[model samples]
Target: MRFTSHTTSADGITERDFVHDGVPGVLWTPGHDPAGLVLSAHGGGRHKRAPGILARAHRCAAAGLAVVALDAPGHGDRVRTAEDERFAIEIRSRMAAGQDAGALVAEYNALQASRAIPEWRSVLDALPALGDRVGFWGVSMGSALGIPLVAAEPRVRAAVFGLIGATGPLVRAAAAITVPVRFLLQCDDRLVARDAGLALFDAFAAPRKSLHANPGGHGDVPEHELAGAVTFLAG
Candidate 1:
């Protein structure tokens, strides 16, 4: 990992920008030693520094946990490939025609994960600054990627995942994850069927897991749930 810039905020949180094997990422830390490390993944089409991600990072940092976020392939500074462009156009067309685009999204997410999981593992290998405890926070497309990562990575002890449904591969991945999980579901998410999301939650093999469902669309996760996640990941 190569650090490109570093800055400290008035509240004693330090932020750093870095590039690892061509992947652009950001890290935020409290001035003091962090109790643990949290890897944050942003929603599809959103970059590492999306408003919601930044809010969560700052809050986690204040709670003495270091937070790291990476711009997923075809997002932020990364160049989109022909496949990515094609998927974008197709999904837009399907949505405009009021057709179900879930399968397209699932396939796209799987492709992204094949590339992203290795990048995340490489970043973890380089980040010796992280303590023993590691957790993951991601939703929507983030969850699509994260479920597989946390399943394969024994280093990750806990996770926050949701805003996604039980695609076949994801359900299999979720079955492999035994870490405590906190899942958030938007009750009225237009993109994800409510029953599908519930089924995904049920697929997790973790002995300790909780589902938080609130009334809203995909983007409207309740504020309290955000606060609760900070507490959950911190502990």
Candidate 2:
């Protein structure tokens, strides 16, 4: 990774911005020695700097865990193509029609993973080793990409994911993830059906997995719930 710049947060966290093979990312480290490393991913249409993702990074750093977040394919500083724009348009149109865009969404997500998952692996390879234990934190689109990542990368010791339903081959991927999981679900998620999300959670092969469900729409996750995720990752 190419180190560009770094600044210290008022809270004593050092935030470093860098690039890896053209993908932009940020890494956060606490003032003292870190417990481990956590890789974070942002939702669709959002870059590595999304507030929720940064907030989670800060929380994790506060607990002495190093955090890394990368801009996914077609997001942040990555170059976009006409095909990418077309795909975005299609997603918007499909959602507006109130159609079950799961198939289309799944296809796009899988394609994104073709680049994103490898990018993550490369980041893991390129970044300076922070610790032996690694965790993953992702939500919505982030979760969509992360499930497969957690399943494939054994270095990822645990995960906090959910918000999108089972899509494409993720069902099979979910079955392979044996790490402990903290899966979040929203009862009235406007974008993802509750049953579909539950189905994905049920597919997890991990013997230790917990589903934390709350009543509200897609982005209505309570702050306490996030704290719970931080506790799980920190532990």
Candidate 3:
């Protein structure tokens, strides 16, 4: 990883911007020794530094956990391909028309995960001393990619995934994961059916997994849940 810029906040957190094999990313570290490392994946249509990701990074850093977020394929600084553009348009049109876009989303997520999973593994390889306590945090599109990553990468010991349903290849991937998992489900999420989310949670192979379901839409995750996630990953 090549660091492009470095800055420290008043709160004693150091932020570094880096690029690894053309993938742009940000890493946040506390001034003191970190509790562990957490890899954060942003939601659909959001980049590595999306507001939610930034907030989580800061919170995790403050809790003595180093955090890193990278732009997925066709997101952030990466150039979007024609296929990416077409998928975006189609999904939006389907949603606007009140049509189910699950199939389209599933296919697109598979493609993105094919590219993203390797990129995340490469990022882990490039970083020094991640140890065995690495954790993953992602929802929605993040879960689309993250489930497969945590399944394939042995380095990731725990994960928090949600805002997505059990679909396509994700179910099989979820079955492959054995790490402790914390899954969040928005009870009234319009994008993902509640039954599908519950099915996904049930598919996890982890012996120790918990589901936290709240009454809200996709983006209405309660602030208290966010605080709880910080505590979970900081352990």
Tell me, by lDDT, which candidate is best.
1
Model 2 has a clash total of 0
**What is the per-residue lDDT of model 3 for residues 10-60, given as tens digits with 9 covering 90 to 100?**
999999999999999999999988878999999889999999999999999
How many backbone overlaps does candidate 3 show?
Answer: 0
What tens-digit string does per-residue lDDT give for candidate 2 at 1-235? 8889999978899999998888899999999989989999998889988889889999999989999999999998888878779889999998888877777777788888777899898888875578878999998888888999989998899999989898647888999999999999998898889998999999999999999999999889989999899889989
lDDT, candidate 3, at 54? 96
Model 1 lDDT per residue over 53-139, tens place: 999999999999999999999999999999999998999999999999999999999998898999998888888778978999999
Report model 1's TM-score to 2 decimal places. Answer: 0.99
Which of candidates 1 and 3 reaches a greater lDDT? 1
| Global lDDT of each candidate | 0.95, 0.89, 0.92
Alpha-carbon RMSD to native, per candidate: 0.7, 1.1, 0.9
User: Which has the greatest TM-score?
Assistant: 1
lDDT of 3 at 178: 93
- Which residue window of length 10 is worst by lDDT in model 1? 123-132
lDDT of candidate 3 vs native?
A: 0.92
Q: Where in model 3 is the C-alpha error above 4 Å?
A: none
Return the TM-score for each candidate structure: 0.99, 0.97, 0.98
